[model samples]
Target: MGADTVYVGYVGAGAITFGAPNVLWNHSERIEAILRTRLAVPVIVDPNEARFKEIMEQKGNGDYADSYKETKWFSSPQEAAMGLDNETKDKIDFWILAAPPHFRGTTIEGRDLELEMIKLFGNKANYFVEKPIATTRSDEPHKVAPQLAENKAVVGIGYMMRYLKVVQKVMSIIKENNLRVMMVTGRYACAYKECHKTPWWMKSQQGGPIIEQATHFCDLMRYIGGDVDMDSVQATTLEHTEPAGEIGVINVDEQAIPPEDRIPRATAAFWKFDSGALGSLTHIVGLHGIRYSNEISVYADGYQFRINDVYTTPVLHVRTPADDSKEQVFSYPEDDMFHNEFYAFLSSAIKKAGKPPLPTEDLLSTEFLSDFADASKTFELTWRIRDISDAHADKLLAQKAASSKKASA
Candidate 1:
């Protein structure tokens, strides 16, 4: 690594499995594109040796065949954080912590790998961390927030939706008009039968669908509407039961896991924003096949903006009284939010280094939307919604149990 070159250390390859189109859309490609640098042999760190080997073997078959070939590998986050030579560590410009949420934690030696890397690299290397920060009920992120802030680590979370062109346009309109958002509504529906067969199906693993999947829309709501009043939040969920044709029923074997550990078929939640705006979100996992429908609409005085199909083809529909109430349609079929987010992050990192000046407006405009501390608020909100939903389910169960006992008596 040299002054002119940028090196990146990837913590996990799970993004390949999680992202659409597999390896092609993984973070590595985007990071490489932003840095304008290619790794002759990329370094990948993962604890699962067999899985890594499988990915390596399948390298030559996918979209970016040559991009998949790599050499440097580490068995654990600790190994990657400490095993790399001092010179290499100092030279690495960025780190992509794409490990699963459960695995993003301190090592057995009680060293926080992320903080350790920040310390080892002298806090120069920026970090791009994945979302849901943690799946379990943990205060680690809250505890780590101060340390990261003290270190001035520029960490970005994986809420790429905030970087979408349509989203940016909506924000611009709101800002230009000085519109006070009155309400925000988000709906996310996914084909549960076709996808989400992995650990995502377990509540204990991924914190249910709201924390794992619909958190994106939740983040967007917060991004557009402002911080949520946590105390004002209320949520309800549709749980799976013995009924055969229930919405919660999925193709997977339900008997493998206890019903309590499974995720809900649908969840609906609403709350008041700190700005006194109302916000609501609904997530349903009952759809079949591989199709997904997602939309978020913002309402203000005499204006409405609805962004639809965010994952595939994003289109924003606008209705305003200024134009005699005529609807205006804007489509962004070629927009790549993932690329836009990474580019913004890498550009921010580069600017911090006093490198060549890049356009400041769009590059860092939405940076706060995905910063670690800011993202933690969204993460905590998702967990709060989960907790509320869980409490409601438990109350119902207790009532059912009491009724059963009385009937037996």
Candidate 2:
């Protein structure tokens, strides 16, 4: 690839979503950032005809849409791959695999695109893939990890929360003070009634909320407190039938979904980190309206860091022994974490391709954070929590059944 231009191949468009009125979500923000880059020319590749038509119809609706008006479009991954191979193999610098989780393992034509990219371009196969690598317990990513290691593919997993300025400040403080993290706690609460009535409601499809939504916090917990001791993980959840008011009911029609396929209304999980630090995460869907409350706190020996309002104006509160334990607050009202994540990946791609470095300093030193193997670990953690919580729910059901049998006898 030349230093003057970067040609990118983007896999999916369904990840783009709207939050508030005329306000794009984080995924959309990422696409906007990529499109706005001076030297990047991206092409959209998707197999869904309906989605393609929908995006075309809505192309003039927002700034993000307007930026991609003249972009190329492909109907399938194979078509895009062939076109790149034939025309711009040397110029193809990076790929954005933003497809749905289920499609990540194998596309519509049963192709492992990530592995194919490695085989086709080797080390030049840089990618920015989305989270929860796979929806189901697929071994494709596990199989591809060794090849990624061999080819040294520059891959960046989409855990954008780590790029927040507040988060960076926390990391700097920890590094400067040589703080040994003692505990990390994260809470994610949102309104269930306001959730979109999509396939996300089906646990079998979306892998439940913990895997789909709360995975962000899980990754952050691992980032702050070292790797987790997977065997020490434990969890419990509030089932839909537990009680009326305990778990908020979805306003969407769910009669088609069977009882077993329904997701938990609330889940609480805790784990022991390899660093001897304890971590806990709670996700509750009982709030009202579209407002969401998300926060995380890290506790060290003599220092405490608490981050609040992650979705809106992020604020970091610090308490240290040197300050007489008085709270010091710092606010970042206009931080674009999604943009930061995109720019980091692009800069790394350019550097790895031997092109002249961009003016912006590289924010991440490593090839990538949350690579395929690391993302697989986070994926395993979420499934482990779901499995344990399901077991707890099963025990409760069995005990209730035994009591009913004894009373009838």
Candidate 3:
């Protein structure tokens, strides 16, 4: 495999799951599959390649390895990076960090590799990080930015939906119409906390729905509604059944929590963005993913784009252009969204330039929006203003200042 194209090296378990945690998950696999067809050689798979091999050994479940049977494997991602050093004669186009589990936040385990990859191969290759870039918004990681810049990190938070063709069209419409997003409505349902197969509902440490799953919707909120100004946020937690005592992994401490009383439900609020766009997001693991599909609708300029089961193709929706009620259609072109997303990250890496030529305003906006979920007994908002030249920064700042005054008034 030469460096003509980016190679994917998926690590961890969730990626190993059957269908998808999200539609783009499957879409990414399909795009990679398509690329494999058009390319001279088959694409590669690193750590995930071995994990599936192990699973097929004992459980006889082919689900994990089936799609990626011919795929390559590396000992660890770093080892894979090293292998590629020789594998491609050091002409790697870019590397994909599709690791899961860190969805909640970075772990103490193998923490060294994260930074080491930045320091050692920092410039050796460019890479892409899946969305929710880190376990949480830990500024501590940016301390390593110089090394990251040296490494030529053309990294992206894989917020595939923002780049969806229709979504982009919506953005174009907004800019074309000079529309301002006023509100967004979203809903999701899953089985009760007791029925969680992956135990994601147990606690945020385990990555309960909102941060782990609903993050895409959060990003879309910003994407469709423009920026947000989170004024205040509140949440209510539920603990009807504490840890129905299931024996577990290193992260699961069944002993500390009694089998009968594990708290699993929480409704949250986020009222804080300089943009002052109010947002409402909710999630419940008590319902089945099959029983409920994702919903997103934006209200702005007396126009709305209603999308149902938005994750997959045929994004269901009713659109309005000022006067007309709305036009509903099916099988709209969303695959292009995934296609653009793929090229955006790869091109950024190849060109060695600014944020993916497509800087997902959606992802950047949600980066702070979800922190509204974690309440600290105090109404809170957090921010870290980046250093930038004054040329146009002041104008954006002045607009926010005027907007804030109007919002307060």
Candidate 4:
């Protein structure tokens, strides 16, 4: 390979990057195609010894794995950095940070290691960090976002739902029709399986389902409908796990846990947008199966529209007086949103020097997608809902206590 060949490095080898149906699983074969026919980049993955052996065993026997045989595996990025000579380091051109959401923090060694890689790589490499960029407790984005933007680095945050073709089409319709937004509603009722089967359901670990999972809807609420007014949000959460209510006690290996009690069973909240339009969210992690029901609706002055089964089977429906009060439906059942999103990042990251202008900022120029800064706004809202909801629950408990005292008197 030539010196200019973009060497891709991955920070984490967990479910999001390499697990079935995730970024690598769905697109590794396509990455092979791109490598063989289009680009000649090498991929380096850093997983601990155990995970490294597991990946080699699981993926090595497959035919496509041969394409990745040339891939270099390391126990950690620091090991790779030390093993590679300065000349070899210059070939490294992109880093993909896909660590679990909870492991991402300012002081977390794993996350700090990736940041050191970014600082070491500098403008020489681009980045694609997955979201929630930082966990609720860490506040790492505040520390990381400035570093990337200050370097004028090319980066992409994994708010890929915004890249859904159906989502874009609906937003375009809103613009073309000259609609004034009035309200937006989003429901992300999903099963335990869809949450990747582990600490995801634990609020302490993954910041609950609202910040970790349902955040996509919250981001879309800002993108399609309008900005959220932080002062106007009212929210509450519910849990149903017996004996360990509000406390996560199930081990990662436990398979028979009640879905609702594992994380938050349900969180119902409403917020007023800066435009004075109302926005509401209903997130429940209590379904069964791989295909969870996800939908978002937008109601404007003269239109009512919705996108349903957004994660799996994306369909759009519109209702207007001009249509005789009938619904106009649109579907993009065959769209591979993940592949499309990865390819978009690849286009900008793989560009030749001085050929044409490319996106030099952390956020891509892609429509409706969020960068770190944009995502922080939504993360802030999630915490806001959390605080308000907890307070409300406490207030109710206090009232009940006061009533009991009066009855005893």
**Candidate that scores best on lDDT:** 1
The true-versus-predicted C-alpha distance at residue 229 of model 4, in Å, is 2.1
Per-model TM against the reference: 0.86, 0.87, 0.63, 0.81
In model 1, the runs with Cα more than 4 Å from the true position are 1-3, 15-24, 37-43, 48-71, 77-85, 105-111, 196-198, 242-245, 357-368, 403-409
Residues 1-409, model 3: lDDT tens digits: 3334444444443442223444324434444543542222113443565555653352234323333444445556566555554654244445555555253224244643345555445555555555444554444334434445455454445666776656656666667888777777666554442443435434335344555566676677665654555324434333333243222332334446543333334334444434555666655545532455567776676677677766655364546663575575544552555556655555455455232232243312212111211211111121211111121334554687799899999
Best by TM-score: 2
TM-score of 2: 0.87
Report the lDDT of model 2 for residue 109. Answer: 35
Every candidate's CA RMSD: 3.7, 3.6, 12.1, 5.1
Question: What's model 1's lDDT at 400?
Answer: 85
Off by over 4 Å in 2: 15-23, 26-37, 48-71, 85-87, 106-111, 138-140, 244-249, 361-367
lDDT string for model 1 (45-111, tens) is 8888776777666655645455445446788766766777776666565678877666553332333
lDDT of each: 0.75, 0.73, 0.47, 0.67
| Stretches of model 4 off by over 4 angstroms after superposition | 1-6, 21-27, 33-36, 39-43, 53-69, 105-110, 192-201, 239-263, 286-291, 352-368
Q: How does candidate 4 score on lDDT?
A: 0.67
What does candidate 2's lDDT look like per residue over 1-409, in tens digits?
2345556666776644312345544454554555344444446678777766666566557554544555566776667666654555566677877776666643223546666656555556488887767766635566666767777776778887888778888888899998899999999997777777756777887888888889888998898898899899999988776784254457766667887777888889999999889999999878888788999999999888999988777899999988955798877777777766766777777677676665653333323556777877777788888889889988987898899999999
Candidate with better lDDT, 2 vs 4: 2
Candidate 4 minimal-lDDT segment of 10 residues: 354-363
Clashing pairs in 1: none
Per-residue error at 282 for model 3, in Å? 2.4
- Candidate 2 local Cα displacement, residue 280, angstroms: 0.9
